[model samples]
Target: MEIAGTLRTAREMGLVACTSCTRVWPAGTERCGRCGHRLHTRAPLALQRVWAWWLVGVIAYVPANLYPMLSTRTLVASQEATIIGGAVDLARHGNWGIALVILTASVAIPLGKFLAIAMLALGVRHGSALTGSRRQQLYQVVEYIGRWSMIDVFVVAILASLVQLGAVASVSPGPASLFFALSVIFTMLSAQSFDSRLIWDAEREGRRA
Candidate 1:
């Protein structure tokens, strides 16, 4: 069935969906017969969970910026650099490509995911000019790009592991590395916890009004 040319959602058609299996059952069914996954018309506490994880991610991000992400010890001296500081240092040395990659993966992607997830949450409740399909696409993009945020952490870890020269030189991950990794993880969780069905719900309600 279609309403105002919008296709009907499963919930409107009296069906429950298994998120894990992508199978639909009659509305009152308890679980998916094929996948044994519990069925719900929508995820419980979806928005609340997103906000909770988002808050923790934000908290972790504060320390991530304030602390050093890399620590180096050489026979002559010691040095440390935060994420942005390291990227800038790389750019100064004409390693512009590496600096750009670090900045984009560490800074731009994470911040963009945060903003996108927040907007998706708010849009579901209050509505927006974006169509339902556009909102869904934004959610998919958030989920897809989130894992790349770990590139900086992986680089730091690999460098730390490879550069152990006893007395000559050593590289170690700094406090900020842990915090940055945590922030990326929590934000990924936030993105996963969103209920995309709500996007269609909001659209349906808008058309009816």
Candidate 2:
């Protein structure tokens, strides 16, 4: 029961296959009925689809950094803070842990995911023989870390809900939240769009007599 290409496009369309018995199953199934093996499925997207969304995320990233991500109001005064400002606030107040979390989740992780995705997309497009394996690893890492970018959004939501003190003090999500979310989503899509089969295809082509 080895995983095979039959499950790739099929799984992308909501089908899956058991890795132990090579049995096909619907996407919702947790295990193969015949062999009770874990299933594997390809994520939707071929290559172009992933690249398109990746590009969108990259484009959105600029505005995500430029615009404010959190706003505060207290005593009839309003203040908006960009990503850097938020980090600075945390650092200045000695909340180093929170500051690091915000920095990594909001700034470093998303950018790293985007750059890695873009590199994978470009590598796949060019069918570069020199670095295919490296690109694949990058793709996997981008996919795995993509969801963590939502931490900032979660924090914003929590603060917004808990800090509602009428005119005394309040916290609100800023425009950058939407952009940052879009950035994360697009990079995830980009990672999904990449087809690992492309590497295999090139390898096969190389081996053909």
Top-scoring candidate (lDDT)? 1
lDDT of 2: 0.77
With a 3 Å backbone cut-off (N, CA, C), the pairs that clash in candidate 1 are: none
TM-score of each: 0.94, 0.73
Please write out the lDDT profile of model 1 over residues 1-209, one tens digit for every residue. Answer: 33634576778788888889888899989989999998889888999999999989989998999999999999999999999999999999999999999999989888898899999999988888799999999999999999999988999999999999998999999999999999999999999999898998988888899
Task: State each model's CA lDDT, in order.
Answer: 0.92, 0.77
Model 1, global lDDT: 0.92
Tens-digit lDDT string for candidate 2 (1-209):
87655533454557776656767788878778898875556434566687788789899988988999989999978999998799999899999998998898888898788767666656655656455566567667777889989888788889999999999999999999899888878877777767675655554455564
Regions of model 2 farther than 4 Å from truth: 1-45, 127-133, 204-209
